[model samples]
Target: MTANKIELRSVNVTRYITPLREGGSLPALAEADDDFKYVLKFKGAGHGVKALIAELLGGEIARTLGLKVPELVFARLDEAFGRSEGDEEIQDLLKGSQGLNLALHFLSGALTFDPVVTQVDPTLASKIVWLDAYTTNIDRTVKNTNMLIWHKELWLIDHGATFYFHHAWDNWEKAAMSPFPYVKDHVLLPQAALVEEINDEMIALLPDEKLREITNLIPAEWLSWEGTNTNADAIREVYFQFLVQRRNNANNFVKQIQHARETLV
Candidate 1:
C-alpha cells in the first residue's frame, strides 16, 4: 500500500457529458483522458450514507489488496440539472442529498464472464474469494462477477456490497455461520503457481504506513457521525482489521494452492 500522492482534482461537470446506462441509476461515460477514463456514476441517485461509505471504503481496500480496480474520486456538480437533464425523475426516487457524483475509472475491457455462465482464472478467483471472505463482501457471486478482462489481465470493480453485515455486528452472537460455498469452485482455486506468485507480490507491495494513509482518504460525509466524533477512527479500525484478516487468509490460501500443486505433481 505505497501511498501514491493522490491529488484530489475538482471535476468540471459541464465539460463531459455522460450517458445513462440501462438499469443503472448514475450517468456514466468513457473519458478522454487515458490516465483515467470512465465517469461511471454521478451523485443524483438517492442511496443512503451507508451505501456510499461502502463504495468509497471498499474501493480503497481493493487497491490495498493489490487488485486492479479503476481509480475512484469524489466529484461535485455546480448545480442540480433540471428534469430534462435526468434529475427530476431521480429526485422523486431518492431521499438524501443530491448534486454530486462519484467518479470511477472506466474499465475498457470486456466482461470475462456473466456471473452465472463464465469462469474466472483460478488464481484470480482465489484471491478475490480471499478478499471477499476478509471483508465480508456479499456481492461477488456467479451473478455479479465484477471481474473483467483487459489486454489479458483481470480487473475487479463494483465493491458496493462488501461489509454489508458490518452494521449488524452486534448480532454476531446469533449470526448463522456458513462458509462461502463458491470458494470450492472458484477459478483461482486451481492456479497454485499463479497464486503463490501474486501472494508474494501483493505482500511486498502493501506497506503499513501507506495502508494507514489510504484509510484517511475515505470521505467523512459517507460515514455515520450521529454527533459521535469517533466515527472516523472507528471506520479506520474496521478497515485495518479487514486488511489484517485478508493478508492472513490470502497467505494460507496461497499455501494451500502450493501444497495441492505439489501433491498433483
Candidate 2:
C-alpha cells in the first residue's frame, strides 16, 4: 500500500431511499452524510458479512488495476432508521447491520453493460476475464453479467459471487489451486483473445505486498463470522494467503482460460 493509495471513506447513512430487490441480498440506495447517493449492501443480509468483504476487496483490486469500479465506502448504519421501515426483512437487515456496511457510490445514470449494444476491446475483455478468473468469480456469466456501463465504458460490480471457495475453509488451499473452468462461459470471453497476455500483465502488476494490502483493507467486523465462529484475523489471513497462492499458481487458471477460449466456436 502506498501513501497515496485510495482511502476508503467512512460516512453515515442519512436516509434509506429504496431497496434494489432484483438481487437476493436486497441492497438499498441510500443517502450518506457526505450527501452522496450510494448503493449500500448490508452486512446482515442472508449472504452475511463475508459478502460485503468480498465486494470491497474484489472491487478495490479491480480499481488498482485500472478497471472501472465505482468508488466504495464504508456506510455506518444507525439502527434507529430500521424502526420506521415497513419491510420486516429490510428492518432486520438494517438492525443487524447497525454499524459499518459496504457501499458503492451510485452512478446516477449508468446503464448495465449490455453486450448486444457494446463491443468491448479485446484487451479490456481479457483483463476483465483475467480479473474474474484469478478471483474465482462465477458471477460474470452471460446471463448475469454483474457489470455497469457509464459514459460508454465498462464498470465492474457485485463481487459477492466471487471467492465461493471460502465457504469451505478447510480445503481452501486446494481450492485456490483449482482451475476455473467456468471462464469459458464468461460474457466477455469471446473478446478475451488476449487473456494470456492479460494474465502476464496482472502478474506483473500484483505483487505479494499489493495483494496483502488489498486484503488488509477489509474491515475487522466484516471478517468476523458469528455463524461459523470464525476469527477476524484468521479469516483475513486465509484471504491473503489464497490470493498470494493464486497468483503464484496462476498457471492453473491461465491454462484453463486459454484452453476454454481455444474451444470456443
Candidate 3:
C-alpha cells in the first residue's frame, strides 16, 4: 500500500500495557484492536530523533525491497500516556534518555531463534542478512534475532539499526561491503536448498512505486530533506546498491546449492 493510502492513527496511551522485556531501551507490549492484534514498542526518551526516523523509514524500505516486515505506521500517544512511575527503574537501565517515547506496534508472531540455538533455514537467514545489508542495518545480530516464523514463513522486525550512516554519508561504501560475510557464511553456506527461490522472491518483490509512496510516510524533519530540501536519494542509492549485491549473491548461492545437491544425489 502507498503511504498516502495508509491511514495513520494515534494510539490511545491508556490502552498500552507494561512491556514484556526488561532493561532494554524501549517499552513494548501486545495490543489489540477490534479485529487485529500487534506488538507495540514504545520509543522511549533514551532514543533520539534519528532512531525514530530509522524505525519509520526502515520498515517501509524493507517492504519495498520485498521483505516480509510487519505493517507499521506513525502513531502518536495521548498526553496522559507518559511513562508510569513504576517505570523509573527500567528507565534508569537505558543508555541515553531523550525525548518522550513513541509507540511501535508490530503484528504478533512467533520468535524464530532462541539465544542458544539458530533454528531458521539457511537461505531464509541469508536473505534476511541480504536485506539488512541492503539497508545498512546493524542490529540483526544473533543477539537481536529479530526474525519471526509463523504459518511456515519468515517475517522481519526491529529495524532501528539502519541509517547508521545518516551521521556520516561517506561511510556508505564501507557499510555496503561489510555485511557480505554474514550473508555468505551464516545465510548461504548451510541451507542451499532455498537460495534460488528466496532470491527470486526478493527480486520480484521490490516495488518502485510502493517505495516512492512509502517515502512520504517518513517524517521530513529526521531526514536530510527538511532544511536543505534534499531528497532521500543518498539513502535510496544505498538501498539500491544493496539490492544489486544481494541479487548477485543469490545467484551465486543458487549455483553453489545446485552443485552441492547434484553431488549429493
Candidate 4:
C-alpha cells in the first residue's frame, strides 16, 4: 500500500439531496461545504463504523495497486442537516451520524458495472480478484460487483463489505490464514488466471510501515466500537498485525483461489 497519499479531506455536509436506496446502509447523495457531491455512508449505520474503516483501507489498498478509486473523505454531518427530511428513517440516520462519517467523492453519470456487458483485461481482473481475496471483501459477486465505469475506465467502489472477519475478533488471528471460499463466486475469477503475480507485487509493496500509515488514517472515534474494550490505538495495532500476518501468509489465500479456479474451469 505504498502510493502517493491523498490527504483525507474533511467537509461539512451542507445539504442532503437524495438517498441511494440500492445501498442497504442508506448512503445518501449530499452536497458538502467543499462544493462537491459525495455518497456519504453514515458512521451510525447498522453495520457500524467497522464498515467505514474497511472502506478506507480497501479503497486505499486498491489505489496502491494502481486501481482507480474515488477520493475518500470524512463527511462532516451537522446534527440539524437532516432534521427537515420527510423520511424519518433517513432523518434518524443523519441525526445519529452527526460529527464525521465516511464518504467518497461522487462520480456523476458513472454507470454500475455489468459483468455481462463488460470484459475486463485478464491481468486487471486478476489484480481486482487478488485485492478482494486479500481483504476478504464479500460484495463483489456477480449479483453486486460494486464497481462503476466512468470515462471508459473501471473504477472500484463500495468496499464497505470488506474485512468481514473483523466482526468476530475473538479468533481473528486464527482466521487470518483461513481459506477464502467466496473467491469462487467472485465475478472476475474466471478471468483472474494471473492472481499470483498480483499477490507477489502487493506483498512487496505493502510494507509494515506503509500499512501502519493506512490504519493511522482511520479516525480514532470510528475504531472505538460499542462491544470492544480496547482503546482506539490498540485496535489500530490489531489491524496492523492482522494485515502484516496476512501479507506474509497470502500464499494460503492465493492457493485457495487457484484451487477454486480449477473447479470453475
Instruction: Give the top-scoring candidate (lDDT).
Output: 4
lDDT of 3 by residue, 1-265 (tens): 3334544454443445555563254555635343344455454434455566667667766766656777664444444343453666544422222223334455455766453555566665556555655555666655566666656567777777665765555655455444333333223234445555666666655555544455555554344533444466655555455445544444543454445445542
Model 4: pairs clashing at backbone N, Cα or C within 3 Å: none
lDDT of 4 by residue, 19-131 (tens): 99976798889999989999998987878788899999999988877899999998888767887899989888887888889899999999999999999998999989988
Clashing pairs in 1: 1-206, 1-207, 31-38, 43-100, 43-101, 115-142, 122-187, 122-188, 123-188
Q: lDDT of candidate 4 vs native?
A: 0.87
* 2 or 4, greater by lDDT: 4
TM-score-based ranking: 4, 2, 1, 3
Return the lDDT, model 4, position 56: 96
Worst 10 residues of 2 by lDDT: 1-10
Rank by lDDT, descending?
4, 2, 1, 3
Error of 1 at 219 (Å): 1.2
Each prediction's Cα lDDT score?
Answer: 0.55, 0.87, 0.53, 0.87
Model 3 worst lDDT window (10 residues): 93-102
**Candidate 4 TM-score, true structure as reference:** 0.96
- Candidate 1, residues 1-265, lDDT tens digits: the string is 2356544354444434555553355545634334456554544453444555567667776776767877776655444433345555544422234444567766665666554454566666656665664455666555556677766667776666665655554433222232333344343444424655566666655556655666666666555555445676776676655555555455554454455445543
Model 1: weakest 10-residue lDDT segment is 171-180
Better of 1 and 3 by TM-score: 1
Between candidates 1 and 4, name the one with more favorable lDDT. Answer: 4
Task: Point out the higher-scoring one by lDDT: 3 or 4.
Answer: 4
Reference-based TM-score of each model: 0.66, 0.96, 0.62, 0.96
Report RMSD (Å) for each prediction in the order shown: 5.5, 1.5, 6.0, 1.4
